[model samples]
Structures are given as C-alpha cells and as structure tokens.
Target: MKKIYVTLALSVALLLGSCGNKNNETSNDEAAIAVEVNQTTENQTNALLSVSGKIQSSNSADLSTRMMGYINKVYVNVGDQVKKGQMLVSVNSVDLMAQKAQVDAAIVQATVAFNNAEKDYKRFKNLFADNSASQKEMDDISANYEIAKAQLEAAKQKKNEVNAQLAYTNITAPFSGTITTKYIEVGDMANPGMPLISIEVQDDYEVMAMVPESEISQVEKGTPVDVLVKSINRTVKGKVQEVSTSAKNTGGQFLVKIALEKTDAPILSGMFTTVQFPITQKSDTQMVLVPVDAIIHDGQLSGIYTVSQSNTAILRWLRLGRIFGDQVEVLSGLKADEIYIVSADGKIYNGAKIKY
Candidate 1:
C-alpha cells in the first residue's frame, strides 16, 4: 500500500509540471509589440490656405485681323520672339492697291481744276475792283472757284479713307511677346476678327486660382503668397494682384490672380501649381497636423493607427484637410492629447499588442 501511494504522488506531480509549461508558452506569445508612438499636439502657425492653381502669362492675347482676304504670307512662326509693331502676317491686298491707285488719280485731277479756278477767281476779283466786270460775272467766277475747292477736298478725304482700309490688310504685333500659336498658313482665308496668332509675355508669369466663397473674404489684394510649381518642384514668391468681388461668372468661386516674382527657375505657362495664402489665425484657434506617411488609405477612407489604453493598435478614421508641405491637416477624429503610432516594426492590426 505504501509503494502504490508513492507512485500515485509522482504521477500527480508530473501532470502539474506539464500544465505549468503550457501556461508559460501562451504568456510568451502575448508579448508587447515594438512600435514608434507620437503624442498629438496643436501648433500656432500662420494658417495657410492651399489651392490648386495654374501658371500663365499676365499679358496674353490672340492676335486677329479685321479684313477678309486670302493670307499672302506669315512673317512670324510659332515660338518666335517679336517686337511691338512687327509685321506678323500679310493678306492679299491687290484689290486695296487698285483702289488706292484710283484715289490718287482722282486727287491729281481735282488739284489741277482747283489751281485753274483759283487763278480765274483772282482775275475776276481784280476786274470787279476796277469796275471792268459786271456783278453777275464776278459772282459766277467766285461760285466756280468754291465748287472746285470743295471737289478737291472731297477727293482728298476719299484717299484718306482708302488709306485707312489698306492698313487692315497688314497684321502687326500689338506688343512684344513670344508667339505661342499660329492659326493661319499661306493661302488660308482670313476673315474679320479671325485669330491669326497667340502671343504671351513669357518672362512675366502669374498664377490663376479659384477660392471658395467662404474663403474669398479672407484674401485681399497685395497680400504676399507662395506658389509651388509641382512640375519643377519649386516655390516662388508672389503677390496677390486681384481678388474678384463677385462670384457671378466663376461658378460660385472667386478668382484670384497672383503675380510671381522673378526667378531663375524654368516656369512655363500652363504649369500646375499650389498656391499658399498666409492667413492670420486667432489666438484661441490651433491646427492639428500629422505626417503624411503615417496616414493609411483604404479606398476613399483615410485613417491612422492609434495607441489604445491597453497598448494595442486602434485604427481611427480621420477627416483630413489640405496638405502643408510633408504634413497634412487633421480636421477631426484625432484628439490633440491622444497618442498615435507613427510606425511599427511588425504588422499592426486592431487589438494587436504594441509598446511605445
């Protein structure tokens, strides 16, 4: 009976040891995961309103002609630099030339008649003074002289009108600029008000941006701004030149023009940009911002991994706002005092153990 009792006690001790080892293995598997954490904070910064914009020349125009005729020759080509009053295009002006020739001939004939009438009027006036001519005779000569002078004046006016019309057959640059487009080629028919070329002053550039009605009131003319050219990855200084008072034609958004300062960066027209307007923030207001890389996206939803009270990851959806440089504005869903996981060494999911 004593031997059997010893064997039973040994078996019971072995079962207890096996149960203890299993519990230790389960505890090890639940170890805390390594992670990097950050405490959310608010910042007092000059609030910037960022909006998409496009770079363009402040002075741009589509050159057009006023006469209808076949194009004779195009003096300037696309990408050519031209000066003010430089001839850009010529239209077929053979008809205008013929009209001019007729006008000139009429003026010459009128001039000869005017000279003869003047000589006769002087002779008649002398004869009347000497009492050698009748009153009716002198009056007739005077009337003839006046009629001849009127005809001469009329002919000169007609020539002036023809000359003015001839100017329309030649197209000239209104201002010094670079030609961006050419619409007419040799032999193409040119009509009145038809655009022939497009020109722009490339050195002077500006940004055109639209601001929501809610924010337009905060923007004022002469305010300085920063324009970020996305294509060249450059930020240039600029000043707000205009702010529309009415949104009637801008699809409910106000248009704002920003004049960029001179820079060596290769900025071209139609380049995409982001304009930042610095606004003064009230003392009580603050903005919450987070690193862009820390935010995860799921289709249209955006969220960030946050640390829970139990040291686990909790994905919190976020309402994001405009981006500022490498960081993004967090409008809601995250508190200023809460802690978030910026990065982790292992995969993170809901309820996954983490350690700061």
Candidate 2:
C-alpha cells in the first residue's frame, strides 16, 4: 500500500513540472514578439513624374506652286538655307511664253482694226460735210469706230493677265528657312496646289506637348517651362507662349507651347520632348517621393512601413500630397535618408515580418 501511494505522488509531481514547462514556452514567444516590435525601420525616397511630347516650331510650311509646268530648275536642294524671296524652283517657261505670244498677236490685230476704223471715220466726216454722205451713214461709221477701240482695250487686259501667270512659274521662298524636303526632280511636273517642298524657319522654335486639361490651369501664357529632349537627353529652359483655351474634343487634352530661349542648339525638329512647369501645389515640387506601393492607406489615413531591425514592419503614419506617375509625394511620413519596403506579392500589414 505504501508503494502505491509513492507512485501516485511521483505522477502528480511530474504533471505539475510539465505544466510549468509549457507556461515558460508561451511566455518566451510573447517576449520575442515584443522585442520584434521595438526595432526601428527607415525609408529613402525620390520624386519622379512621366510626361512625353514632340519638338516643333511655329514656322513650318508645305511649299506648293500655283501654275502647272515642267520643273526646269531646282535652285535649292534639301538642307539649303534660303533667304526670303529667294527663287527655290523654276518651271519651264515655254508655256508661259506661248501664252504671252498669243496675247501680243491679239493686241496687234486689235490695233490694226482701230486704225482702219479711224481712217474710215475721217473719210466719212469729209463726205458728210460735202453732203455726199447721209446722216444714218455717218452714225453707222462712228459706231464701228467705237467698237474697234473697245476690242483693243480688251486685248491689252488679256495680255496683262497672261504676263502675271508667267511670273508664278518661278517658285520663291516666302520666308527664310532651310528646306527639309524637295518632292520633285528637275523634270517632274509642277502641279498647282501640290506640295513642292517642306521648309521650316530656323529662328523660331517651340516644344509641343499635350497636357491633360486638369493641368492647364497651372500653366499660363508667359509662364516658365523646362523642356527635356529625350533624343539628346538634354534640357532647355523656355516659357509657355500659348495655352489652348478649350480642351481637345478627342482626348480631353490641351495643347501647350513652350517657346525655347534661343540657343546655338543643333537640335532639329520633330524630336520627342517633355515639358515641366512649376505647379502651385507643393506635391508637384516635392524633393522626396516614393513608389505608391510603399504607401499604405487606412480609411483617410496614409502610412508606410519601414522594415524594423528585427525583420518586422512598423507602420508610420504619413501626410501625402500630389501623385505623379507611380510615385507619391511623402509630405510627412518619410525621411530622405531611410529605406522603405516595396512589395511584389502585395500582402503586407502594419506589423508583418519582412525578409528584404
């Protein structure tokens, strides 16, 4: 009976020892979690935005001709600098010459007719005074004289019109520019209203960008602008010369023009560009911005997690402003020198542990 009592006492003591070990394990886990929460985290950020456009100028023209003729001389080749009123191309003058000849012949015929009528009028005047011509005959002769004089004037006017058409056969540059294209060879037919060449004046250059209508309010005429040429990776400063009053019907964008301050720019037309304007909102000019993925939102509250030293995350509340591209301006929550977490899988929490 004493042995049985001894065995029961040992079993009860063993049960108590097991419960104490389990309690110790649970307390250790709770302490580990507290230590993880205390570790501090950091985030570093940058400001970024995405906008694109093309470079252009206010003076570009598709030159054409007014008369149909064979191109006789192409004085200016592509890339040749021309002065205003410089003859660019000349058409064959043979047709114009023939038209002028026909006009001259008509003028001569009209002159001869006028002379014959005047001689007859003089002869009739002497006959009428001698009473050898009737009153009706004198009136008829004068009427014929007037008709001949009228026909001569009409022929002279036609000659002037032909001469004007002849001058149009020579195509001249309306403004000083470098010819970017020459569509016809020396022998090609010059058709009226067909583009002969494409030219762009060099002195005036501007960048063309399609900005959203919402941003138009921030830009105004004479407002300063910065144009970044993507082709050359160079930046040029300019001013906003024009802002479209109404939004485009198709895309709801407004056309913005940034007239560059003249440089010795070897920059050519039609390069892709980006124009940046100083927006009134501070977010638009924030120095430190971070990817949107780095920011977390709760109701109206904003925050980001800096991976704690213990490999867990501590949510830090933030004040955010304008959003550009995939980046957000961190108005308050982040420091420029710290590092923040960006997730690929998208599952993250205020206190979630992170590996990287």
Candidate 3:
C-alpha cells in the first residue's frame, strides 16, 4: 500500500507541472499577437491649411495751407466727411481786405494818369504836324505817355496778386475723405506749410507684406492672403495687388501690396495686423486620399515607401507636390489605392514586415 500511494503522488505532480507550463506559453503568445496588431494600424496624419493677412486704405492726405492767416471758421471737424475740393477752414480776411483796398486805390490812380497822358499825346501829335512843336518835344511827350500806360498795367498785376492771396485764406479738401485730425480751433492763427488736419480715404484699402526672394517665384498678383486684427477681432482676406520689382530692407525680401476685400465693419486706420500667405496649394480630395506616413527625406531628395504584391514595403523614390498642413502630395512614383506604412514612434524601415 505504501508503494502504490508514492507512485500515484509522483504522477499527479508531473501532470500539473506540464499543464502550468503550457498555459504560460499560451498567455505570452496572445500578448505578442495583440502588440503586433496595434503596431500595424497606427498612422500619423496631416490636414488642410488656411492663409492669414490685413486691411488698409490706399489714399490719405494732410490738410495744410501755403498762406498764413487767422482761422475764421473750421468747416469740418474730426470725423467729418468731405468731398474733393470742398472747403475745410476759412482764414481771417483782415490782411487780405487791406491788400485789396490798396490795389483798388492804385488802380484808380493809374487810370487817371493814363487818361491825362493820352490827352497830352494827342495834343503833341497835332502840334508836331503844324510845326508848332519840335521833334524832341513830341518824343518827350510820347515817352511820358508810355510810362503812364506801363504804370496802369502794373496796378492791374497788383490787384491780381491781392485776389490770389484772398483765395488762399479759404482752405479746402484735396480729396474725398473723413477728417481724422483737427489741430486748429476757431480764431487760431494758421501758418504756411503747417498741418491743420488729416483726411484719410477708407473706400480703398491695401495691406503691405514682405515676401522673401526665396518664395518670390510662388508669389504673383491676385494671390489671396489672410489678415487678422485682435483689437476689434476683425478677420479679413486680401489679394496681391503689387509686388516690388526691387528688394526691400530685408536681406532679400520684396514689398508686396495686398488689396483687402472691403467690409462694412469699422476698421480704424493703421491698426496692427497679423498676416499669412500660402506658398503652395493642395486639393482637398488629393490630401484626403494620400497616406500620412512613408515620407522620407535625405539631403535634397524626398520619397516614401511602396508595397509590392507580396506586401513587402519598398523604399521607392517619389516627387512631392503641394504640401497642405501635415499632408504632402506625391507627384510621381506613387499610384492611387496603394498601401503605405505609417510610423508610430518615427521608427520605420523598408522590408519591415508589418502585418496589416
């Protein structure tokens, strides 16, 4: 009986040990399979991008005058709209009035002198014809008459100068715009070449952006750009209206003018803005259909992975097209409906059998 019990215990111990070993092996195999599955399905992705830019006016003017005088009345105040050639300020007429009066008196004096000289010349001509006056006497009278006529012409010129100065007393707008500044008040003395107000035309606006020479080939007239101003939370779009033929202050960047699409929103002039421009564009359909991974770059060459019929990942050369955000278009060497591997931790390689 002792011999039979010992044998039976030994058999039971061996069977349990074998069963435990099998279970441990099975669990490790299941875990390994799960990890492989997760690795093949993961992929990084890219999406569409939008451009950014600002708003600006094309016309502006500083109100000024050439003649100095007192301001009689300011016809337009700050924020007042004015048309081209419309009156803006009126100067005091005291000095201008005096000038006009002096010219008028001189004209009267010149006219009387001219009339007397004409009568004397007629008398001299008659006397010379009758030999009652000598040639020298007639010549002297002719010279006096010419002097009086010259004086009369000078008086007319003086009157014209006074009238011109009078016109300068009234200031007017040179272009259509709203008055953005008012530096003078009623009865303020105005000085020549001094600013009185500022007028800015808001109907036409333009945004200026500097584009680097490296990207000049991609920039052209009518290219769209976007602008954002946080002050008013104003977002606007604009187009490239001008591109400088010569470089600007930047090492090799050129000034580009983008005309904004007008808006009814109140946008203050000279507001600081953030702008963005797109160097290239990709279609939505092409970006959505392409794979996110398999892109590789070495030196100047860029390409991606391609799979053979046996599902082998091959490092094939490819030409890249437009880059839209995280996505890039393959211009050549990649066909539609093809499968490529995406990296999880950026560690991926050709001939790597990722069971997808």
Candidate 4:
C-alpha cells in the first residue's frame, strides 16, 4: 500500500511539471513578436497639388488670308517684331488693280452722261412748258436722265467693291507680337483661310494645366501657384487666371490657366512646366500626418495598424486628405501622438502581441 501511494504521487508531479513547461514555452513565443512602430504627430505643412502643363503666350494667332492669291511679298521674317496695323504680307494685286481702273473709268463715263442728260432734260422741260417741244420729246429726255442717274449709282458701287478687293491684297498685323512661324514664301499660292504666319504676343505668358475633376474646386481664380520649368531649372510664381467650367474630352479634366509674373529668363512658348497649387482647408481642427506606406488599403477603404495601450496591434480605418510627398494627411481614424506600426512585415493582425 505504501509503494502504490508513492507511485501515484510521482506520476501527478511529473504531469504537473510538463504542463508548466508547455505554458512557459507558449509565453516565450508570444513575447517574441516585437514590431517596430512609430508615433504619429501633426505639423503645419503647406498642402501642394502638383500638375504638369505647358507654357504658352497669353495671346497667339495664326494669321491667314480670306482671298485666294499668289503671295507677292513676305515683309516679316521669323523672329521679327511687328506692331499693330503693320504690313506683314502682300498678295498679287495685278488683277485687282485692273478691276479698280475699269471701275474708275466707268465712274467718269457715267458722270459725263449724267451731266449731258441733266442739261437736255432741263432744256426739254422748258420747251414743253412754252408749248414749243412735243410731250413725247420731254418724256424721252426724262427717261434718259433717270437711266443716267441709275448708271452713276451702279458705277459708284462697283468702285467701292473694287476698292475693298484691293485692300484685301495687303495683310496687316492684328496685334503687336513676334512672328514665330512663316508657313509660306514669296510666290507661294496663298489659299483662302490657309495659315500664313504665326504670331505670339510678347511680354505675357501663361501656364496651362489640366486638373482632375476631383481637385477643380480647390483651385479657384486668383489663387497663388508655383510654376516650375524643368528644362530651364527655374521656378517662378504665378496666379490662377482662369478655370474651365466644363471638362476636357480626353480625360474629363478641367483646364486651369496660371498667369506667370514676368521674369527675366527667356521663357518661350510651348515649354513644358509643372504647376503647384496651394490649398488650405478652412477648418478649426488639426490633422495628423503619417508615412504613406503606413496606410493599408482594403478595397476602397484605407486603414492603419495602431498600437494599443496594451501593445496589441489594432486595425483602424482611416480617412485620408491631401498627400504631401511621402507623408499623408490623416483626416480621421488616427489621432496625434498615437503609436502606429510602421515597419511590420504585414503579418501582424488585430490582437497580435507586439514587443516594441
């Protein structure tokens, strides 16, 4: 009986010791999950929205003719400066000049006929009143006078039409600008509505950018902007001059114009540029900032792994705001001074033990 009790006691002791060892091993494994985390904070940063575009002149035009004729002379060359109303090109006017001469001769002939008819009508009217001329003779004189008056009026109209045609032979500058392109040379057939020369207004330029429809509201007219020319390695300040009320056909983006302040650098038209629009939300609340990679996406919702007071990872869905470089603005779900997992291998889940 004494041996039996001793054996039973030893067996119970061994079983209890094995259970204790297993518990300790499990605890060690649980404590080994240490994840590097970072504390999130808020900072006042100027929110910037970047968009790429091209620099263009404030006013540009492709000059063309309305009448088809051979180009007689191209007075301005590429890179030439011209003033408003300055003659830029000329068309062959030989036919127009001959037409003008014909109209002029017609005018003189009509005037002479009108004068002779007027004298005859007055003399016949006086003879008819004195009963010396027949009624038929007076009627014929009156008809001749009327025909002469109509002819004179037609001749004047022809002269005016010919003069207008003659004026079309000369092409004048519509505005003060620099000639950037010449599409035709002397003796080239200048077709109607065909572009002859391209001119751009000097001393004024604007940067045009296409903004996504989601960001169009934040960009308003007169808003300040920063323009960067990558090729020239230059940055200049500008303002939002205009915003399109409608969307573009390609990508449903709205066009935004930034009028650049004049700079000494030779910023030519059609230069590629990047524009930065500064936006500030009018809110009395503060926003938190975190690394871009710290945020995780689950379908359409964004979330982040936050470290709880017990050092357990807890997933919290986040509402994000404007993105600033590598940092993102946390509009909600994350608070300032909260600890969040920043370097986890994405294996950490909710309620998981974290050592750091």
Candidate 5:
C-alpha cells in the first residue's frame, strides 16, 4: 500500500511541473510592442524650400564723412530720429571758416577789379570810336579788361568750392531715419571713408537670404514667400523683390531679397529671419507622402519605421525629396497604402512584434 501511494504522488508532481512550463511559454508568445501606425498616401503638393537669412532695412546707409576733421559735436545719439538734411554732426570747422573768409576777401577784390575794368573798357571804346584814342591803346585796354574778367570768374568759382567744403564740415542726414549706430563721439578724429553713424528707414524692411546654384532657378522675382522673424516671434508675408544674377564671391551662393509688407509691429534691421520659398515641380508620376515626424535620422541617411505584412516593425531607409509643411515627399523605398509607425511610446526595433 505504501509503494502505491508514493507512485501516485510522483505522477501528480510531474503533471504539475509540465502545466507550469506550458503557461510560461504562452505568456511570452502573447507579449507585443505597442505603437501608433498610419498608412501612407500619394499626393501632389507644393514643396516648401526653407532658407535662413537676416532682416534688413530696404533703405539703410552707413553715414560717413568725405572730409577728415575732429568731431566737434554729435547732435544725434544712437536712437535719435532725424529728418532729411537735418544736421546730425559738426566737425571742427574753424579752419574751414577761416578758409572761406579768405575766399570771400579774394572774391571781393576780384569784383572791384572787374567793375573798374568794365568802366575803363567802355570809356576806351567810346574814345576809340570818337578818334580820341589810338587803335594800339584800345587793343591794350581790351586785353586788360579780358584778363580782369577771367580773374573775377575764377575767384567766384573758388569761393563756391570753398562754400561746398564748408557744408561738409556739418554732416546731415541723407534721409529721414533713426540713428542705429554712432561710431564717432565729441573730440574723436574722424577720417574720410570712416563710418561715423548708421541709419535705417524705420518703415521699410526686407529679408535677405542666400540660395544655392541648384535652387536659384526656381526662385523668381515677384514670388511670394513667408518670412519668420524669430526675435519677434512673428510670421509675415513677403515678396521676392530682387534676385541676384551672379553668385556671391565668398560662398558662391546667390542672394535673394524679399520685401516685407508694411506692419505696425516694430521690425528693425539686422534681425535674424527665416524665409520659406514656395517652389512647385510637376511630375508625371505621383509621390508617396508621410508626415515629417514619421521620418527618422540614421546618421547621414533618412529612414522611417514601417510594418511588415506579418504585423512586425521594420525600419525602412528612404530617399526623400521636397518637404511640404508637415508632410514630406518620399521618392523611393516606400509605396502607397503602406503601413508605418507614426508614434511609439516604447523602444522598437526590426522584427519586433507590433500590436495595432
């Protein structure tokens, strides 16, 4: 009886062990990776070409002097608003003033000489006609009158030149604008060609961007673009005002000028900006489309997560084309009606079980 009881216990123990192992295997098989997925579709959309640039005033100038002198006074500060022809700076003009005085004295002397010569010439002409003066005397008087007249004209021209130089001693605004930069101060020695101040027209602004040679052909004058001023955190509409025919000397990139629409918001020059150029390329065949978020970077190559027919996750490498807003055009390595992983809360890999 004891042997029979021991045999029954051994059989029951073996059966329990087998059942536990089978349950563990079933649990492992049921485990799957959970991720949100979407099916790609074909579409025709205008591709957006994004290029970075800087905000600049459509009318900006680096105000400088043409004559060298010590700065006597700066009437405007960095933020001063000035009108066209308004005096902004005054250089040391004592020397210029003295020079003008000398010119004035010379001009006065020449005027007096000219008057005397004219009177004498008239008198001599009358005397010669009346036979009171000889022909030799009239010729000599005429030559003296002509010489005095020439000297008087030359003196007047010299005075005018002196006055023009005197005007330069007082620098004036070329246009109505706000002073953005002040490089010269009182008592600073300023030289010709040295920038003294900078001004920008407050109401006029534009964005300047560089485009590569390959993309320059797509950008055309009058094409509308979207400009984003990151500093202001605002997006504005702009039009292509000008496109350079030749490439830049340094980078070989072509320059593109975009004129922004007038806005009440304060848009200053030299602010960083991003410009989005809309370019459309027609194709005989449709292209596959996927959200920009769906694409992943794999160190020099672009790829996306795709689902296999068996509902397993697989990483697919793709050749991408133009980008359109949130969607990107897929040139190859993907097809229409294909299921792709859009979002995953957990780590995923190739051959990983995907749960819908």
Candidate 6:
C-alpha cells in the first residue's frame, strides 16, 4: 500500500509530538515569584474600639460558707498567699462546740440570779429610806429587782448569740488575697452559699469588657484604655473604671470596667484581654489594615496572597476583623488600594507569576 501510508504518517507525527511536550510542561506563564508587596492600609487613626476582655482581680471574692458543715479544714491551697485575718476554712466546730456548751450553762445560771437580785435591790433601797420598806413593800421589791436584772441581760445576750455562731465555724481571709479557687475539699460538704474559696486581689488588675448597646454610647467614665494581654504578649495601661448604665444583665452587652494602670506586667487573674476603645470615627470611615504577617491560615480558612492584574498569585479568602496591633482587620476580602503578598521569594501558587 505505500508502506501503509508511511506507517500512518509516523503515527500522526508521534501524536503531535507528545502533545507539544505536554504544552510546555503545564505552563500558566510560570517563572516569576519574587514577591513582597503590601498596599492595603486606610486606618485613619483615632477610632480604636477593640473589646473582648477578661483579666480580673480588682479584688475578687467567692469564698462562701455561712453555716453548713463538714469541710473541717481546707486552710488555703490554690496558690495560697493569704493574710488579712488569715485562716482559710475550717467548718466542723462540733456543732459550734455544742452550742458553746449550752451558752456556758446559761451563763452560770444567769450569774446566780444576778447576785440574788442585787441583794434584794439594796435591801429595798435601805428599807424604803427609813419607812422600813412599804410603798407596797418597795413596789414588790422593785419588781423582783427588775426581774433579776432582766434575767442577767438575757444570759449575756445568749453568750453573744453563741459567740456569733462561733464565727461561722471559722473561714477568715477577707482581703489580702491570692487563693484563686479551691471550692472545698477536706471531706467536702460545705453548703450555705457553697463557693468555699476563690480569692484574688494580688497586684490589682481589671478588665471585664462587654460593650454593645450599640457601642454603649461610646464608653465614657475616664476613658484611657489599651489592655491587650492575650496571654502575656502584654500591652497594659487602662482606665475606664465601670460604665454599665443598664443592659439588663449583660446579654445586651454593656458592662465596661477597665482599671489596670500600675502594672509590672505578670497580670494573672483569668488573663485573655483586648480592650483598646478610643472611639470617635465619622469622617468617611474606611478601615482596611492588613499585615498580621500576611495571614493565610487554612484550617479555619483565612487567606491573603492577592496581586492579580495578570501579575497572578490571587488567593484572597479573608473576612477577619479586630486585632489592630500588628495589624489585621480586613473584614471581607481586602480592599483599600489592594496588592497584598507581603513576603514570598519563591513558592506561591494560583497561576503563580508574582514579581514585586
């Protein structure tokens, strides 16, 4: 036949030269990636407002117990350090020492009937001043000397009400603190108001934060905030001491607090902060901000890359907000003048070709 048409034209020219070397090894205009771009800023300064807070201890408490027994002895433990009236917890005062031994046997039988009614009211006021006693016999011996001096002041006020219920079986420490939390343990039980131990006041910190009745009327009471203590990466300096004009109990937010100025940082109490707050922002309000090391997380999404006007590399994703220190608000895939990337020098993807 023509050698079978010259071997079917050499197998269609080696199948079109192996698809043109696989289209030049999958090219999407490859080689370029030398990135380091940036451009998205627009924060216009004075308009902070961060929020989310916690760091407590503007003198905390909890330490419950008003009379229910069993705990017998917990004596401080969770980080100890007590002091103001010390003695942390005791409880089993054997029924308040058997009711202080029945109020010391009714105060020794009312001090022997108040010394026999003050010797029969001073011998009936000296025999009724010489009438040898008789204005109805000195008014019936001055009414049995005022009923034995009111039963010896009612047995010394029932032994001062059993020594104030034996100081509630001892639990002490009302100030000078640092216990942090132990909620009863030496044989447990404790009930009247439960709690048992929590303490705090060690260096005085405070933050609280809630804000939102549409920005709690722009938070006022002394202003001056900053806080940001997200686990030791510190920031400190605060003021706005309390500002909750009602949010019916925090679900609608409101509850400010702040107060953390004198810090040698090492804050403690619950930690986890982020206050900021410098309000005032109306002049066209834009706010984009970006550099949290150029983001790009992945597990919970959050991306960045950008650049694409044919200079390629376009990941995008974003939707973040709040973290204005090392920069990071974006709230919707970037904008303020675009350009992103911030760092690269090689491996970047999506149509690749970068180059700034």
Per-residue lDDT for 120 in model 3?
96
Question: In model 6, which runs have C-alpha deviations exceeding 4 angstroms?
Answer: 1-22, 30-48, 54-61, 65-90, 106-108, 126-128, 131-158, 161-163, 166-182, 185-207, 210-218, 221-241, 244-278, 282-288, 291-338, 341-356
lDDT of 1 at 26: 74
Q: Cα lDDT of all candidates, in order?
A: 0.90, 0.77, 0.72, 0.87, 0.86, 0.82
Off by over 4 Å in 4: 1-46, 117-147, 248-251, 281-356
**116-181: candidate 2 lDDT, tens digit per residue:** 999999999999999999999999999999999999999999988887887788888888989999
Instruction: Kindly indicate the candidate among 4 and 6 with the higher TM-score.
Output: 4
How accurate locally is residue 206 in candidate 5, as Cα lDDT from 0 to 100? 89
Clashes of each: 0, 6, 6, 0, 0, 0
RMSD of each: 5.1, 9.8, 10.7, 9.0, 4.4, 13.9
Q: Which ten residues in a row have the lowest lDDT in candidate 1?
A: 24-33
**Preferred candidate (TM-score higher): 2 or 6:** 2
Of candidates 6 and 4, the better by lDDT: 4
Could you tell me which residue pairs clash in candidate 2?
42-339, 43-338, 43-339, 43-340, 44-338, 46-289
Better of 1 and 6 by lDDT: 1
Candidate 5 is scored at a TM of 0.76
Candidate 4 on 259-280: residue-level lDDT in tens? 9998997789989987888866
Q: Model 1 over residues 1-356: C-alpha lDDT tens digits?
A: 99999999999999999898888867756566789989888967776778889999989999777778999999988999999999999889898899889989999999999999999999999999999999999999999999999999999999998888778888888899999999989999998998999999999999999988867888999999999999999999999999989899889989999999999999999999999887665689787888889999999999999988877899999999866556788999997988999999888887888877
Better of 1 and 5 by lDDT: 1
Residue 204, model 2: lDDT of: 77
What C-alpha lDDT, on a 0 to 100 scale, does residue 171 get in candidate 6?
79
Better of 2 and 3 by lDDT: 2
Clashing pairs in 5: none
